[model samples]
Target: MHKTLSVATRLAAVAAVTLLGACAGMAPAPVFSQDSLPDTVKVPAGHRVVLETVGVGEITYECRAKAGDAMAFEWAFVGPRADLNGRDGKKLGTYFGPPATWASNDGSRITGTQVAVAPAKPGSIPLQLVRANPATGNGAMTGVSFVQRVATVGGVAPALPCDAAGAGRKEVVKYQADYIFWKPA
Candidate 1:
């Protein structure tokens, strides 16, 4: 049963990779060069974030601020886990990046891409901020301390398990993450 569960998880993460493939083109940017900006300028780079896909499930993403000016950033999916697996290790749960897809949002909505597969493969996921109609934020992706969630639209969610159900599709349960950016004074 444990072996089956592991296989299922792998399959799920693969599914997620396929899903992000559709949105691959719209992915944001990658990590900036070491000298892109001054050492004093701290931009949101790589940070683990928990995000919900509303009706889908919860997802964990390594949210990184885009190198240049962007309303969003890159995400590295980590896969998902559930409160408790059902009889067949199948249950409503969350999925994170396998290092394939990345997700992000504007403290409201979230989205991403699968640069690689298996939340911890060997690549990064793309992400962006949830922007309203006509996003009007600065192109600069600022560094931030984000809280990912499996549910809760306005709350910060935590990270999901790596070897739970649905590791392939890596579905995020719902709004359960929070991200806060510290403005430079």
Candidate 2:
């Protein structure tokens, strides 16, 4: 009985260690570099990078008729729902929008516009070059000038057909991307 109890305790300890290691591997923090920013996200001469965040989100889309046509299917961006993470895997904020907003831990936020887009890998949303509208809060995002959504994975709109009958139908697509925020140097 003593030997059997010892074996059971050893097995439980091993299982606990394995579980902890797996959890640690689930979502490793992202690495960043200025040189790694995609060309699609243009940074005007002398503007410096202020912060970079890694975002995991769903890019929502709505099925509607193509513009200028009444019987076609087209996917239109509704907005996004994401959790922004810092380099240490800490939750920094949440991103959501019709006018994309990045609200950080310290209550700072910024909105932006799509200035440019580049092709992304198959099955993923296109890389975006966004220009910040202006800083709203007095947080980490204050004075932010531009933002880039790159290294995209998944989040493509579904291939559902949309007619006038399906005009308002919505779909949520899963995606992950790195968002780099910039400011004037």
Q: Pick the candidate with the highest lDDT.
A: 2
Task: Record all residue pairs in model 2 with backbone atoms less than 3 Å apart, i.e. clashing.
Answer: none
- Candidate 2 structure quality by residue, lDDT tens digits, 1-185: 35455888999999999999999889854434547556765566767766778899898899877778777768898889999997678999989997788899898888888898888889988888788877777989888888888789999988877667788999888889988888888
lDDT of 1 by residue, 46-110 (tens): 54322223223354544444447354444444554223222233332222434212222332211
- The TM-score, computed over Cα atoms with residue i paired to residue i, of candidate 2 is 0.76
lDDT of 2: 0.83
TM-score of each: 0.19, 0.76
Q: After best superposition, candidate 2 residue 180: deviation in angstroms?
A: 0.5
Worst window of 10 by summed lDDT in candidate 2: 28-37
Candidate 2 stretches with Cα past 4 Å from truth are: 1-31, 34-38
